[model samples]
Target chain A: MKAPCTVALDRTPLYDLHIASGAKMVPFAGYHMPVQFAAGVLKEHLHTRRQAGLFDVSHMGQLRLIGVNAAAALEALVPGDIQGLVPGAMRYTQFTGPSGGILDDLIVTKAQDHLYLVVNADRKAADLAHLRANLPRDIAVEPMEDRALIALQGPAAARVLERHAGGAAGLKFMSSAAMPVMGFACIVSRCGYTGEDGFEISVAGQDAPALAAALLDEAEVAPIGLGARDSLRLEAGLCLYGHDIDTTTSPVEAGLAWSIGKRRRAEGGFPGDAVIRRQIAQGVTRRRVGLRPDGRAPAREGTPIADKDGRNAGAVTSGGFAPTLGAPISMGYVRAELASIDTPLDLMVRGKAMAARVAAMPFTPARYHRG
Target chain B: MSETKFTEDHEWIRVDGDIATIGITDYAQEQLGDIVFVELPQTGDTIDQGGDVAIVESVKAASDIHAPVSGTVETVNDALVDEPGKANEDPEGDGWFFTVTLSDPAELDDLMDADTYKAFVAKL
Candidate 1:
């Protein structure tokens, strides 16, 4: 049977570059992105770990919230302590709905007199609407459509970036500052989805091609696609917006309560703060946990997890054959009572139940540079 | 020497006497990136001409390998279970999927030759 054809939504500045590099493009989150290149997913993933990999994350939504008290206005909607964030620092936070459910997870970085934010491409429209409806009239949520975002990730990522943007070597994790990349003004942050020591560079769309080319010129760097990106993040135990965490799942149950600042939790002003605070105080009915399947058969998404007595415990949210682990691994939400490290569980794969266990998050230890 | 034939479905069969070795084409492996697992029928299993006899799962998607010709499965490549990347590394050589004893040798004539398969892939 022929596979369904994907309609191109929008092309990044590096669209032609991707094709020239032998990338296999696919439609994802309303944009045409490279799924894999000639190197294959496993090789691309391993290469990223051993060195730096360039990812075209221009499909993600980039916005600049400009106002006198922009942080205060944003703090009203999100649970993170945005007001206390020092200039040139970033924080990972979530947009909360009126019902206390999460709208989307995003990155908020304090820039020069403005707040720079990056949101998921699939939920950009919804995120903007939510921000406008709740934010006061004084604040302006301007979408930076002319900017393209790229991620340079891995242990050697800093070396590659510093070669262009001098002084970036001093930036710590979750920090951002204006830097000249390939002679273009860019906001470089020490952050990324791969859980590696990396930087997310936001540059002008027109300059993206040159900057991408400059990074690729380095002998240590190669173009990574969405296929490898997903596997890398999965191994890092990072939550994907739509798959792992969604509007229906609360941040507490998703094991992201640490993202909520202590001051914000005490003040209790953000949307869904009451419900979330209660979940934190009492406890959630279920919690997200990682699983390691006993065999090579991958426990794919939607696979039902059962307890020892054949009781439905949970369902696999994301699962695959982890190349690093050399076996199948999965992540899913399970009953709170059974959410413990080394807890034995069973995954139903193709009618045969396979043994599994509830392991701690980050199947692979995150290599983010805190220094 | 007998000629090898290719199917539009991407399966290739090299017939030598009564035995034929079947595997996927290079174009097919490229389309299915990073093969992670393979499921093959055991020896002695019967399959129709167009019936599915094997399966291959990649990180991106899963695909069914249909039998190119009606035959009884004579052998399977057991080495593929632990090293599925062999299909990606050498799809036509070491990655040969399974061997079958052809039930009808005449069915081979209906398949495309290497030249025709090259043209078919070029159109895609």
Candidate 2:
């Protein structure tokens, strides 16, 4: 969630650790978070793909929906089949506005007694208000303000986490469990934003530093910062909250129709149900597609895109030099006709046209531990 | 005689005869993180002081390289096109962006020397 930096920023539980590790701190999502460590962004990104990287994601909001009717209440807001989520299973979904635009994307996990949610930091307050005003009165929305979230991601993440929590390595992807890590109670979810196989651990704020230090002590774990986190997720072809999917973009146009469960697709109870159903049936005028620029020059966010004939097509929402591919990669919305794979296009960078083309996403293949 | 000077934009210039070699300072490269691409000016291109001459791209963002003095581009470090990490490894030497034939040697007087540049960087 890349938001404008304001003067007053909060610090995460690991802020002192980041400073001690020589991290370059920057204001992010109302927090002074590390952008990169001494290893720099490139190395840190490559390392996470090969090994494991620990990220301080405490700035994100964690909340719980109590009462048995919570799942049904949330289903009224999103198109996902929240009621079908079995205990310990997680599902990725978005909060949609009445106009079919996405308010925010979040991960919801079904716990023993409540529905746990992890939402973007910048949108947390509004999300809370949305839940309180819309959800039924019996379903209580409790913010987990005392907790901190950290993600251990990459190929070696399972191994690093296994040393602390015995059962974590065995959990299947998109699953969660309450486990003890370094003797501290925590929620370990076998999932992450990076396309790599990993886990997100939620622990009490006070126990965060010790848990992070223990993970860093592992030979395979490196403390990754937000810079690598952004590039990694981009390479994974995942949509960032504000950049890729915002209030102006809908689930179908954003290429997120697959996230809408089959049951939810047939039943029309959620917000923007009619608009989403119409788009899903008739298709959207503009569709988000992955782009690969022909040259080494990076096409950043908001760069204008044109069709081969030089007509306006769309604008890049997220573009950067993918360290994994050694070339510039981007994701943007284009006219439905131009969204096909291999459709040639031009990216206007500084008034110069750079050759680009639509490509298949997950620019780097997703390596999820499905077992 | 060769003399080195620095600019507030974190660029360094080494004057040799009528040619001036330019590259970003180590601190600038550090601030930029890993340099992935360095767009160089073509030889014979004329530039004025403070003109946008090159573009240095890191994995996350791009930065403009402004000319510190007026000159005509002479030679560029073509190797940086494929191995831009050189800018991070040896920013002041092999990572030099381009060399230009100075239009006016007097422009050097307006730049900071090594000592002043170091002091200037310290305050930031």
Candidate 3:
């Protein structure tokens, strides 16, 4: 159709650079982002898996929680073991509602001085308000609006980063450190949404273009867009907030129990901890699972799922053509009894019953740098 | 070297007497991105001039292919069903959607020629 724009969208620091590189820009989460470049979505997706792909993730909200009790304050809101998080280590967790539903998915890193947090762009305003209202008046949630986030992901990402920032490759998975990226002071983390081993670099917004250009200059790196990011994360079995998970879905139901630390599950202090604990013990009616459609027809979001008798079972949340799998893969909530692997099901596409099966998640194996 | 008529909706039709071949324009394929699957109408089915006919599903979205003129469907491109990317590769040639027996050859006169269609797309 027409280019994806409906309202006044924001631009990232690399916006003009993307256009100069022939990227097809579109509206995404209130920002005008490149969905594909001249190489197209399919090509960009595969290149990221095989080598490396540079992505502009500056739209995400970066915040610094400054207080004497930052981790303790955040632990009251999230289920993750923030108190146990060592400085320079990041933990993935969701901000939950009083009823235990997910407010948003975020990554919180225990920086040297204060706690660093990166939240989804769409939920930043509300996330900030929620934090401010919940935490004591002493804790200040400072927004880093002047910062830009870029991800260099794939198998060769480490070597490329090693060339520019020699200290980046030394960090382990989910680890962060302040290093010089392309001669600019940046917080480089060995983490990314993609299943590939990579790093997410946070730097001053003005220095983003130089950092992005330096990464693009690497032989293994190519500038990618959001289109490939979605597919790559889908194959990684990662949940997309407001889609795969939301205020209606809980952590246990969404299969994110691991994110809730063992001590937090027992302590029972965070918001909605009671409801989540009950779901974990008694189990949930519906659970998120991976689905493999029988044919080439992709069962997109909102596609209905049916049982053997053609009775309505559930609906697809995130579905698309997974480039790595070479076929269509989807993740959605289904009846708990039917959430097990190899459970035969049907995805109703265009009034026809397309045979499907509940398969193991992370449709593509993760290549995270564990060391 | 050729004569093909186009509709404002972006379909391109090549007529040979009463039998006509229908497909989307190059511009249409470019906008649709990579075609993953296609649903074509059944053979022998009758369609109105402006009725919604087949469907083309790209990686991004699914778009309905409207009938350019009243006709009876004769055959579909099965090759496209197996390899949908062919539509992106050669949208004007081997990517033809279907063949139809025209109910009225006069409807073809109302369509825009190659040169007129090119200028019309420039306005968009």
The candidate scoring highest on DockQ is 2
**Candidate 2 structure quality by residue, lDDT tens digits, B1-124:** 8999999999999999999999999999988889987899999999999999999999768999999999999998999888999999999988999999999999999999999999999988
Listed models, DockQ each: 0.60, 0.63, 0.53
In Å, residue A10's CA in model 3 sits off its true spot by 2.0
Tens-place lDDT digits, model 2, residues A261-360 = 8899999799999999999999999999999999988888999999988999999999998999988899999999999999999999989999999999
- For candidate 2, give the DockQ: 0.63
lDDT of 1 by residue, B1-124 (tens): 9778999999999998988999998999988888998888899988888898888888876688999998888889999877999999999999999999999988888899999999998988
lDDT of 1 at A137: 92
> Which model scores highest in lDDT?
2
Per-candidate clashes, comma-separated: 1, 0, 0
- The candidate, 1 or 2, that scores higher on DockQ is 2
Give the lDDT of residue A262 in candidate 3: 85
Alpha-carbon runs more than 4 Å astray in model 2: A1-6
| Candidate 3 lDDT, A207-324, residue by residue in tens | 9998898889888999999989998999999999999999999999999999998899899798999999998889999999999999988898889999888888899999988888
Give each model a TM-score. Answer: 0.94, 0.98, 0.97
Each candidate's root-mean-square deviation in Å? 2.1, 1.8, 1.5
* lDDT (tens digit, per residue) of candidate 1 on A305-367: 999989999988898877677777789999998899989999998777999999877988899
RMSD of 1: 2.1
Which pairs clash (backbone N, Cα, C closer than 3 Å) in model 3?
none
Better-scoring candidate (lDDT), 2 or 3: 2
Query: What is candidate 3's local distance difference test score?
Result: 0.92
**On TM-score, who's better, 1 or 2?**
2
